[model samples]
Target: MTIRVVVADDQELVRSGFGMILEAQPDIEVVAEAGDGEAAVAAVREHAPDVALLDIRMPVLDGLAAARRICAGSRCKVVMLTTFDLDEYVYEALYAGASGFLLKDVRRDDLVHAVRVVAAGDALLAPAVTRRLVADLVRRRRAEAATEATPDRLAVLTAREVETLRMLARGLSNAEIATTLFVSEHTVKTHVSNVLGKLGLRDRVQAVICAYETGLVTPGAP
Candidate 1:
């Protein structure tokens, strides 16, 4: 199916450039454009696109706030990310429910790929921007344990389930986790599902964020 899209940015050139790239893709169609945050929300509700590529800084409403509003109201996947991979707005955008992010300087192929990835219901990290927040390993572990202290859904996780979750937070892909733990890929997939369900998260994006915010995974760590 064609992935319907909306490009929202205050800059005319940025919007136009994005439109051009999306328009060239057979699987992606630029359904609308919004020059500001409020208009972006309006356009998204009207067009009901499969994905909304939102810029963080826009007039009328900032992309971060707009993403929160849009994601709250729409079923569409929201990839509220940026052109500059290091743009700090990205962190807030993720907290606001962006499914994927990319730098504006990202190659055309990578840009298009990000859209497709999010549209498929996956969340993405800013490419190569793993965090460097410096709580020591012990402190980090303590923080993670604390963040999960009152998780409403932990009751649902088995001992094995929790083990799978920690490894996932460590950034191991399903295949890798499976190999490391000597399990099948299908088994890992089942554990991932239970983790999401028990944690009350929307997808892997939120899970990744939880992994970070709860101090389970530090981006820059090995």
Candidate 2:
């Protein structure tokens, strides 16, 4: 099946660049292009593409807002774009339900692969960019703890789950976790899915944030 895509960016050049890269893939097709967030939302509603490639900064509406609406309204996967490796909006985008987060200058292969990942209903966030997302979540979690009551989800995780999650949040893929725990990859996937379901998280990205929020994994710590 062809993976229909919508490219949204403030700059025509960037949008064209991304659309060009994606169109080259035999399994990919560009269904629409939007120059702003509002337009992006409209395009999704109009095209109902399989994946939406959105830029973080746009006039009238930003990618985060657009992603929120798009994800809520449709089953289409959202992939947020950033110029910098560490974007302040990256954390917000994850919480907004983006299926993937990618840098603006991503390689052709990476961009193409990211689209396929999202289309497959699997999420992806560049490991380098995950640092900022985790850091931001940790900070917000501390603030929330000071204000609201403790989240019950934090207690829902079992000890074994906590261990699996910490490794996952640290950017270890399923294969790596399976090796570390001496378990099969299928077992690791099951544990990860259970963690997300119990916590009501959308995907592994939120699971990553949860790991940091609960202090299960410290950023940059061995």
Give the top-scoring candidate (lDDT). Answer: 2
Alpha-carbon RMSD of each model: 3.9, 2.2
Best by TM-score: 2
Q: How far in Å is the alpha carbon of 9 misplaced in model 1?
A: 1.0
The sequence of per-residue lDDT tens digits that candidate 2 reaches over residues 1-222 is 999999999999999989998898899999999999999999999999999999999999999999999988998889899987677787778878887688887888888988997797567845566666666667876887776665556688787788888887777888888999999989988888889889888777778777777777776665
* Segments in model 2 whose C-alpha atoms lie over 4 Å from true places: none
The stretch of ten residues in a row with the least summed lDDT in candidate 1 is 130-139
lDDT of 1 by residue, 1-222 (tens): 999999998989988998999999889999999999999999999999999988888998999899999888988888765667556666566666777566667788888888887887665643435332111323444555774554434456788877776676665778888998899999988988888888887767667666655545555556
Model 2 misses residue 81 by how many Å?
A: 1.3
